[model samples]
Every structure is written in C-alpha cells, then in structure tokens.
Target: MKISDIASISDAQKFILDLYPNDNRDFSYVFGYATRHLGYLCKSLCKNSPSVEEFIRSISWLLALANKLEVDVEVSLIKRHPDICPYCVVAPCKCRWTGKKPAIGIKAYKIPEELFYRAEQIKREKKADFQSHCERLAIIYPGNAYKWDAIGPWQLTSKMQEELAEVHEAATRYLSGRKSIDAVAEEFADLFAWLLSAWGLSFPEGNVDDSFIEYYLAGCPVCGNNENCECELFADLSTQLVDSDKIKELEKLFLALSSEVGFDGDEVSEVLQSLEAASKSQSEPVARAAVDQAKAKTEELEKLVERGAKNAKNATTIAQAIYKAIENFPFVG
Candidate 1:
C-alpha cells in the first residue's frame, strides 16, 4: 500500500485494528500504552538515542485511540490548520509580525479530497517539517490559554502527559455515567495533537526513522497476514520480554498509587469494560459516547489545573504499569 493511502488517519487505524483483531483492550489501556511510548520517546531524546522506533510506536497508539474514539483525525487537523496558518491567515505565518491573537473559529481553506493531499500541500506551501506543523497548530488554536508561545521539547512532553491524564479522567467519568464518549474523544484529540508536537520536536528535520505504512505494508509484522493472524507469540521475540511477575508487581504498585491519589478504581475498571465492548462490536453509540466523554474531560481538566497535575502523575504511573505489562508484546505490525 502507498504511504498516502496507508498513512491517512483512518487507514492507519484500520491497519492497526486488523493486526490486533482480538483486541478488546480498554480506552485506558490504549491511552496508557500511547503515553508510555511517548515517555520512551522522551527518554530517547534525553539520552540521545538514535532510534526512532519509539516515536513510531507512540504515534501508532495515538492513531489507535483516535480510531477507538471514532474521531476524524484528518478533519480535526485540517480544520485547525489548512494550507495557510489559521492564525495569521498567511502562508508564511505572520502571527509574530502582526502581534495579534489567532482569529476564533476560523474555517480551513482549500481542504483537499484526501488528507494526504492536504499534507503534501502544507509541506510545499510552508516548507515545514512535522514540528513546524505543530507550532502552526498552536498558533491557530491556542485553546483557552490566550497566548501562543514557543515551548521547548521538555515542556511539550509535559503538556502531552497533561493531555493524556485528561483523557484518562474522561474515560473514568464515562464509566461512572457522569459523562459521554464525545468528551473522551475530544481529550483524545488533544492528546494526539501533543503527540504530534512531540514527534516534530523529536525529529525536527521531518525525517521519521521508520515509515508507518512501510512497516505494516505486508500486514501483521509477526503473522504476515492482513486478517485473521494466528501468531501465538505476538511479541517480537528478539527483544527481552517483560517478566509476568514484574508486571504483576507493577500492577500492585499502580493500584496502591491510584488509591493513595484518590482515584476511583471502580470507575476506571468500568470505563475499561466499556472501551473493550466498544472495540469488539464497533458500536456507534458506544464510540460516540466515548468521544463526548473525551470532550467533557478536556473542558473539566482545563478548569482544574492543580488537580489535573495530580491526575497527570497518576496517569504516568498507570502508563508505566501498562508498559510493564506489554513492553515485550510486539504488535509493530
């Protein structure tokens, strides 16, 4: 498959779902895995590791969350950033020159039939890399923060963690019957935006070490099938598998931390159950609820920055637990 066809947000989601056909993992697990890979990306950057595998993995999880939540990633992106900077309404982005805030609720100009086409147009028009795209997006949709200032990689990673926590909380609320899935989807979108920002920061030259499409072009990386994969050993056997005992230990640690932090365990498990159900059946209502829940969570987090910080820390712990559980399982397919 061509990169253009496979790399579109929709196609990527389908490809990932196909590789893990039996996946009934919850939204928390998905978000947790994504966050974990992002944390790895941050580690690689900090340690000056040349590998980009973690970046690709992180992006994959974000795309998977987008699929699970039924969010149109392409639409979300293009709407905020078209051919020109949505803020300055200029190709070269005159936001700094104009010293004015981005116009509110502006629509995208020249939306293409395919998201890939739009991406290419953006590349040509701006001569920008992945990181630049993120910067432009921050300018266009500053959210409620009022100002669009340059943030360093560390800050970007921190923001990414914050968004991840918001998504987690939204999922928890959805399980508790206090919110809808749409709210969850919205927070997932925010998390995705931050992941993209991290991606750009990690690879400023626009050179991704691995092509997501190419990696999966032949189907499941392990089973080598587009459907009905039957690989008993899903993990990349080449890497050391995380010990099952270690995972259990980490799980206990996570539970302890969650309790200490006053997280609702019942609600978290309920959200996970709902997410698993949604994934298995692809139920429209269930997926839609998750999206609305994501949106609600985002709004709620914005209002509770201090509490959000605590939640973010908890989320990191949860993600660490998840990584311990699956770090050995390879689905690079």
Candidate 2:
C-alpha cells in the first residue's frame, strides 16, 4: 500500500519470488497462483468503473499492484500468449487491424455457436491425457478461461438472451409438464449466465492477467484481448455491472455460511456473490433480507415453497435459486 511497497514490486513472478524467493519452484507456483487471484480481483473491480478512463485507471492500479509485487507480466505473455481466445472467438483473428470490424479472413478460424458448443462439450468430455494437457497449460498462457468454463451463462447473458433463451423456453416447457426442478434450474442458470453478461458480472470468477505483458502490450496485439475482451467474457460481454445492494448481500453470504448447516465453501461464497451481483439493479431492502432468510432455510426443511411464499418470492436472486431447488422439492419441515 505504501509508495515504497508499490515501487519495490516487480514482475508477478518476481514479486512472488520475493515471497519465497529462495525456494525456486515454490516461488514460481505461489506467484502464479497469487497473480491469478489478483487478476480476478482486478477484473472484478474494473466492472465497477463507470467510464473508460476510470476503467483504464482501474487497470493501471492492477498493473502497479503486480509491479509492487515484482512481476514481469509482459515477458510472460510473449512466451505464452494465446494465438486466439479459446473461449469466445467467432473467428480466430488474422491479427489484422485496419481500424474496426474485422472481415473474417479465414473461414477455417471461424466457428458458429452450435459447433462451438459442441466443441466445448467435447473438451469437457476429453480423455484424461488430453484434458490434463489442456489443464496443464491452463494457467500458463492466453488464458484457458474459455475451454472448460468457457460458456459462462452470466458472463455471456446478452448473447444467450439473444440466442439461448430458446433453450430456457424449451426447458420451461419441459418443466410445465414433468416438473423437474433440476431441469428448470439447469436451463435458468444457463440462460442466467448469458443474461448476466449484459450486466458485466459473470457466474464464474472473471480473471485478469498480471503478467508484464499487460503493462506493455495490454492485450494480445494479434487478437482483441484485454481485460475487457469479450473472448474473456462468457457471452457478448459488456462492462457495466455494479450494485451496492448486491455487494451488501454478498457480505451477508458469510452469514449464510455460518447460518446454513451444511452448505458452505469458497465456491459457494463466490457463486452467491456472482448471483447477487448479476441480479437486476434495484435496492429492495426487505426483499434482500427475506432472500437471505430463504438461503438460511435452504439447508433446513423447506416445504413446497411456491411463488409469493413471502416477500422472498420477489427477490429474483433468492427466488431463482430457491424455486429451482423447491420447484421439484420445496424444503419442508
């Protein structure tokens, strides 16, 4: 935090090296992990910024944070930079820029959403060795956020709202007759992921890179890669997600963990935070409180919790998650 501390930081790797500077391997591992976390935090904060200038400032601070830690994020990118964003690229960039709007130079590099979804599924179902290879190279490059966790529903909400709602509609249709809560949930979450993108918040951790490459190149010069890159996004990502109320709700999640008997983990914390942030922007204080109550009851006996069960029914965040759970099996005491 101090200016001196800020200046002393080096490449993300070096800053990490300082943590355990003597133990070479451990130093590298911890630094990479820490930088990864920092990246996610930076990406998160960037969404809170209102203007592009402010966004740039947000990023600069992240770079400085990496510097104080001593990371050469630049060289790291040069060595391992991804040719194409493996997550949301419609066309593998030919690395050309004559201003804006790239004309798909090569058809081979392009993929439609249908095929893209199929490829994504195949990667998920990859053979052990193949999967390992992908995972192994994951943290080390142009960012593997897309490969497995590629299709972030919340992150890609806009594109999904534009395209995937049909899937959710179909799911809703299925639920009308069969009443499978889980099915409804799957579709809702899938559609939600895409819808949330319109808000700039994402379901999964949206990451940032602290590599020196960020300091110099900013993004992959070849492709439109930046902290704001849509490829890094889960959908046709926008950058305007913010809600003090949701943030307030997220703090309540710690209480959710303590209040709930058996459902708490960093994963749950992160998921709860994302869901709250991605909800429509309006401060419904009473509704918020009721939603928290439902979350607390979730692990207990919830019985046929239907629409308007209480003020909670109106809290979209709680209602969606709870209804999905209760749709088929409402927690009953």
Please report the candidate that would top TM-score against the real structure. 1
Report the lDDT tens digits of candidate 2 across residue range 198-237: 2233222322222222332444222344332223212221
Question: Per-residue CA lDDT of candidate 1, range 1-333, in tens?
Answer: 333455345555666666655356666667776776677666555555524566667777777776666665555555445655544555545666666533333344532233346556764565333344456654544431232133335566677778878877887887789888767766765676666655555555554423666566676656677664565632432322223343334335434444445554564444445445544555556544533443333333333434655566655555455444333332111
- What range of 10 consecutive residues in model 1 has the weakest lDDT sum? 234-243
C-alpha positional error of residue 204 in candidate 1 after TM-score superposition, expressed in Å: 3.3
lDDT per model vs. reference: 0.54, 0.34
**TM-score, each model?**
0.50, 0.19
Best by lDDT: 1
Error of 2 at 143 (Å): 19
Q: Give the per-residue Cα lDDT of candidate 2 at 306.
A: 35
Q: TM-score of model 1 relative to the true fold?
A: 0.50
